[model samples]
Target: MANTPGAKKAARKIARRTEVNKARRSRVRTYLRRFEEALSAGDAAAAKTAFVEAQSELMRAVSKGVVHKNTGARKVSRLAAALKKLGGSAA
Candidate 1:
Protein backbone atom coordinates (compact mmCIF):
# COMPACT_ATOMS: atom_id res chain seq x y z
CA MET A 1 0.00 0.00 0.00
CA ALA A 2 1.52 3.31 -1.11
CA ASN A 3 0.49 6.05 1.28
CA THR A 4 2.29 9.10 -0.12
CA PRO A 5 1.53 10.58 -3.51
CA GLY A 6 5.04 9.96 -4.78
CA ALA A 7 4.89 6.36 -3.72
CA LYS A 8 1.54 5.89 -5.39
CA LYS A 9 2.82 7.35 -8.61
CA ALA A 10 5.86 5.12 -8.46
CA ALA A 11 3.69 2.08 -7.88
CA ARG A 12 1.60 2.96 -10.90
CA LYS A 13 4.71 3.45 -13.00
CA ILE A 14 6.10 0.12 -11.87
CA ALA A 15 2.86 -1.60 -12.77
CA ARG A 16 2.90 -0.09 -16.23
CA ARG A 17 6.53 -0.96 -16.73
CA THR A 18 5.86 -4.53 -15.58
CA GLU A 19 3.17 -4.98 -18.22
CA VAL A 20 5.41 -3.58 -20.94
CA ASN A 21 8.33 -5.76 -19.91
CA LYS A 22 6.07 -8.79 -19.80
CA ALA A 23 5.00 -8.17 -23.37
CA ARG A 24 8.57 -7.71 -24.49
CA ARG A 25 9.63 -10.91 -22.77
CA SER A 26 6.79 -12.81 -24.37
CA ARG A 27 7.71 -11.44 -27.78
CA VAL A 28 11.29 -12.57 -27.33
CA ARG A 29 10.15 -16.03 -26.29
CA THR A 30 7.93 -16.28 -29.35
CA TYR A 31 10.82 -15.42 -31.62
CA LEU A 32 13.01 -17.93 -29.86
CA ARG A 33 10.37 -20.60 -30.25
CA ARG A 34 10.13 -19.90 -33.94
CA PHE A 35 13.86 -20.24 -34.26
CA GLU A 36 13.85 -23.50 -32.33
CA GLU A 37 11.10 -24.92 -34.50
CA ALA A 38 12.98 -24.05 -37.64
CA LEU A 39 16.16 -25.53 -36.29
CA SER A 40 14.49 -28.73 -35.21
CA ALA A 41 12.79 -29.09 -38.57
CA GLY A 42 16.23 -29.03 -40.26
CA ASP A 43 15.34 -26.00 -42.36
CA ALA A 44 18.60 -24.14 -42.37
CA ALA A 45 17.32 -21.16 -44.34
CA ALA A 46 14.25 -20.62 -42.23
CA ALA A 47 16.28 -21.20 -39.09
CA LYS A 48 18.79 -18.59 -40.14
CA THR A 49 16.05 -16.06 -40.73
CA ALA A 50 14.40 -16.91 -37.45
CA PHE A 51 17.74 -16.73 -35.69
CA VAL A 52 18.32 -13.23 -37.01
CA GLU A 53 14.87 -12.10 -35.93
CA ALA A 54 15.28 -13.71 -32.53
CA GLN A 55 18.66 -12.13 -32.02
CA SER A 56 17.25 -8.76 -32.98
CA GLU A 57 14.35 -9.11 -30.60
CA LEU A 58 16.64 -10.32 -27.80
CA MET A 59 19.01 -7.41 -28.24
CA ARG A 60 16.13 -5.01 -28.35
CA ALA A 61 14.87 -6.42 -25.08
CA VAL A 62 18.32 -6.04 -23.58
CA SER A 63 18.54 -2.44 -24.76
CA LYS A 64 15.09 -1.75 -23.35
CA GLY A 65 16.13 -3.22 -19.95
CA VAL A 66 13.64 -6.04 -20.20
CA VAL A 67 16.56 -8.48 -20.05
CA HIS A 68 20.09 -8.29 -18.71
CA LYS A 69 22.90 -7.59 -21.18
CA ASN A 70 24.89 -10.72 -20.40
CA THR A 71 21.84 -12.95 -20.56
CA GLY A 72 20.96 -11.56 -23.95
CA ALA A 73 24.49 -12.07 -25.18
CA ARG A 74 24.54 -15.61 -23.90
CA LYS A 75 21.24 -16.44 -25.57
CA VAL A 76 22.37 -14.91 -28.84
CA SER A 77 25.58 -16.87 -28.65
CA ARG A 78 23.77 -20.14 -28.07
CA LEU A 79 21.32 -19.42 -30.86
CA ALA A 80 24.19 -18.68 -33.22
CA ALA A 81 25.91 -21.87 -32.25
CA ALA A 82 22.77 -23.87 -32.86
CA LEU A 83 22.28 -22.17 -36.22
CA LYS A 84 25.83 -22.98 -37.14
CA LYS A 85 25.32 -26.60 -36.21
CA LEU A 86 22.21 -26.71 -38.34
CA GLY A 87 24.08 -25.24 -41.27
CA GLY A 88 26.87 -27.74 -40.85
CA SER A 89 24.46 -30.64 -40.77
CA ALA A 90 22.60 -29.52 -43.89
CA ALA A 91 25.71 -28.95 -45.92
Candidate 2:
Protein backbone atom coordinates (compact mmCIF):
# COMPACT_ATOMS: atom_id res chain seq x y z
CA MET A 1 0.00 0.00 0.00
CA ALA A 2 1.43 3.35 -1.08
CA ASN A 3 0.28 6.09 1.25
CA THR A 4 2.29 8.97 -0.29
CA PRO A 5 2.20 10.28 -3.85
CA GLY A 6 5.89 9.54 -4.40
CA ALA A 7 5.45 6.04 -3.08
CA LYS A 8 2.51 5.49 -5.42
CA LYS A 9 4.55 6.66 -8.35
CA ALA A 10 7.42 4.39 -7.34
CA ALA A 11 5.06 1.44 -7.07
CA ARG A 12 3.76 2.10 -10.55
CA LYS A 13 7.27 2.34 -11.88
CA ILE A 14 8.22 -0.89 -10.20
CA ALA A 15 5.23 -2.65 -11.72
CA ARG A 16 6.15 -1.44 -15.19
CA ARG A 17 9.76 -2.41 -14.74
CA THR A 18 8.72 -5.83 -13.50
CA GLU A 19 6.65 -6.43 -16.62
CA VAL A 20 9.50 -5.29 -18.85
CA ASN A 21 12.02 -7.47 -17.05
CA LYS A 22 9.69 -10.46 -17.22
CA ALA A 23 9.38 -10.06 -20.97
CA ARG A 24 13.13 -9.68 -21.34
CA ARG A 25 13.74 -12.82 -19.35
CA SER A 26 11.20 -14.76 -21.37
CA ARG A 27 12.81 -13.61 -24.61
CA VAL A 28 16.21 -14.69 -23.37
CA ARG A 29 14.81 -18.08 -22.44
CA THR A 30 13.36 -18.41 -25.92
CA TYR A 31 16.76 -17.76 -27.45
CA LEU A 32 18.38 -20.30 -25.15
CA ARG A 33 15.71 -22.82 -25.97
CA ARG A 34 16.46 -22.42 -29.65
CA PHE A 35 20.06 -23.33 -28.99
CA GLU A 36 19.04 -26.23 -26.77
CA GLU A 37 16.70 -27.63 -29.39
CA ALA A 38 19.37 -27.44 -32.03
CA LEU A 39 21.89 -29.04 -29.75
CA SER A 40 19.54 -31.85 -28.81
CA ALA A 41 18.71 -32.43 -32.44
CA GLY A 42 22.45 -32.81 -33.11
CA ASP A 43 22.40 -30.24 -35.85
CA ALA A 44 25.85 -28.77 -35.43
CA ALA A 45 25.38 -26.02 -37.97
CA ALA A 46 22.01 -24.97 -36.65
CA ALA A 47 23.21 -25.20 -33.07
CA LYS A 48 26.20 -23.03 -33.89
CA THR A 49 23.98 -20.36 -35.41
CA ALA A 50 21.53 -20.51 -32.53
CA PHE A 51 24.37 -20.39 -30.03
CA VAL A 52 25.75 -17.24 -31.62
CA GLU A 53 22.38 -15.53 -31.48
CA ALA A 54 21.68 -16.73 -27.96
CA GLN A 55 25.07 -15.51 -26.85
CA SER A 56 24.27 -12.08 -28.21
CA GLU A 57 20.84 -12.05 -26.57
CA LEU A 58 22.27 -13.19 -23.23
CA MET A 59 25.01 -10.56 -23.22
CA ARG A 60 22.47 -7.94 -24.15
CA ALA A 61 20.30 -9.02 -21.24
CA VAL A 62 23.24 -8.74 -18.90
CA SER A 63 24.04 -5.27 -20.21
CA LYS A 64 20.40 -4.27 -19.69
CA GLY A 65 20.55 -5.49 -16.06
CA VAL A 66 17.94 -8.14 -16.73
CA VAL A 67 20.49 -10.77 -15.68
CA HIS A 68 23.60 -10.75 -13.48
CA LYS A 69 26.97 -10.51 -15.19
CA ASN A 70 28.35 -13.75 -13.74
CA THR A 71 25.17 -15.64 -14.49
CA GLY A 72 25.31 -14.55 -18.09
CA ALA A 73 28.97 -15.48 -18.35
CA ARG A 74 28.36 -18.92 -16.88
CA LYS A 75 25.51 -19.58 -19.28
CA VAL A 76 27.63 -18.49 -22.20
CA SER A 77 30.44 -20.72 -21.01
CA ARG A 78 28.22 -23.77 -20.74
CA LEU A 79 26.74 -23.21 -24.15
CA ALA A 80 30.19 -22.77 -25.62
CA ALA A 81 31.29 -26.02 -24.06
CA ALA A 82 28.33 -27.80 -25.54
CA LEU A 83 29.06 -26.29 -28.90
CA LYS A 84 32.65 -27.34 -28.66
CA LYS A 85 31.56 -30.88 -27.89
CA LEU A 86 29.58 -30.78 -31.09
CA GLY A 87 32.87 -30.27 -32.95
CA GLY A 88 32.27 -26.59 -33.56
CA SER A 89 34.49 -23.69 -32.58
CA ALA A 90 32.71 -21.41 -30.12
CA ALA A 91 33.81 -18.04 -31.36
> How do the predictions measure up, each by TM-score?
0.94, 0.98
Number of backbone-clashing residue pairs for each candidate, in the order shown: 0, 0
Q: Mark the regions of model 2 whose C-alpha exceeds 4 Å error after superposition.
A: none
Error of 1 at 64 (Å): 0.2
lDDT of 1 by residue, 30-79 (tens): 99999999999998989988988999999999999999999999999999
Query: 14 in model 1: Cα distance from truth in Å?
Result: 0.4
Candidates' C-alpha lDDT: 0.92, 0.97
Query: Against the true structure, what is every candidate's RMSD?
Result: 2.5, 0.5
